[model samples]
Target: MLIKTFENKRIGIDELTGQVISGVTFLNCDFSKVDLSETEFVDCIFYDSDRQLGCNFRSAKMKGASFKRCDLSVCAFNFVSALGLEISECKAQGADFSSASFMNVISHKSWFCSAYINKSNLAYTNFSKVNLERCELWDNRWTGANVTGASFSGSDLSGGEFNSFDWQSADFTGCDLTDSELGDLDIRTVNLEGVKVSRDQMSELASRLGINVLG
Candidate 1:
């Protein structure tokens, strides 16, 4: 059975946490500054695919908000302070996070990011110009993700599937890229400074550049 549909409602901080929400549809709702820590959403729809509308999460504190097996396609997460947000085994296709801030600003130049987005399908998600540096973003399908001017620097991106992904669209310096399929990634054209890769991955990269790594 489908649960309640929340539309244009201002949900409280203690409204939804540590509870298992399933098959609920949220449309144009305001969840700003609501503490949804450790909340589990199963098969929930945060975006109306038929109408192309999405819920608002602007400046909402979603620390440790976990979403498992949920559909967050085309959702708007602009300016959401989502530290430790876990989105495992979910489909977040076309989700817009262009203006989201994951860092707690202690100063202008000193800050840190935290988010665990693993084992999910984030294809075509919009992360343009977002700062996701030093975060745990491993083992996800990132095909056609919009990462224009975004920074994934110093992030753990191991075992990620990046088919049809643009290597030069984002800053991936100092990223852990071991055990991943680096599709069409030309090392000579992109900056791989401090980026880690396995021996076999190195061989594959070398072959792409037409350099023979004979051992």
Candidate 2:
């Protein structure tokens, strides 16, 4: 079903499940308390047109969905499978994205402060210039993700697998990187000021930098 020009409408939960919606223009629509499980949306636009009312996609299965310049701060994407999702210039502060599996996702110039991405698998995702300040990213499989210019200030990134990504442009100010698997990361450009890393991890970085580990 291709839903278009849908504005200021309160859609019930019964009309969302098992529907394959494309090119949906849901501006200022109320999707709160709505169960979007088993629903697939493609090329959809959820914006706040002349209003700041929020939308919810908690536990929804949204594959190839895209949202631009929207304030999805109140949306709870917990346990959702949003493959190839694209969100630009959006704010999702304090939202819950825990246990979500989002592959090839791109979020640019967006704010996700205090958000939870715990136990999520976001491999191959691109988060260039995104504000991830104070977010909970524990136990996430975030390998091969482009985090250039992304802020991790005051965030808990414990047990995250960071494989071969650009660490130079990532801000680690006051961030907890305990038990994070940073394989062969160059510390020459990484911001380790006030960053909380394990002793073993520090030694590993020192050893890679040709610093004396003995004495």
Each candidate's TM vs. the true structure?
A: 0.86, 0.51
lDDT of each: 0.85, 0.62
**Candidate 1 C-alpha error for residue 213, in Å:** 1.9
Residues 87-159 of candidate 1 have per-residue lDDT tens digits of: 8888888888887777777899888888889988889988998888999999999999989999999999999
lDDT of 1: 0.85
Top candidate, metric lDDT: 1
Scored by lDDT, model 2 comes in at: 0.62
Model 2 lDDT tens row, 1-215: 64567777877866886576666777767665455544555556564536644455655655555444444543456555655454534444334455455543347644234345555455655555556676666776666666676777888888978886667767878888889998657778666788888888888889987885664
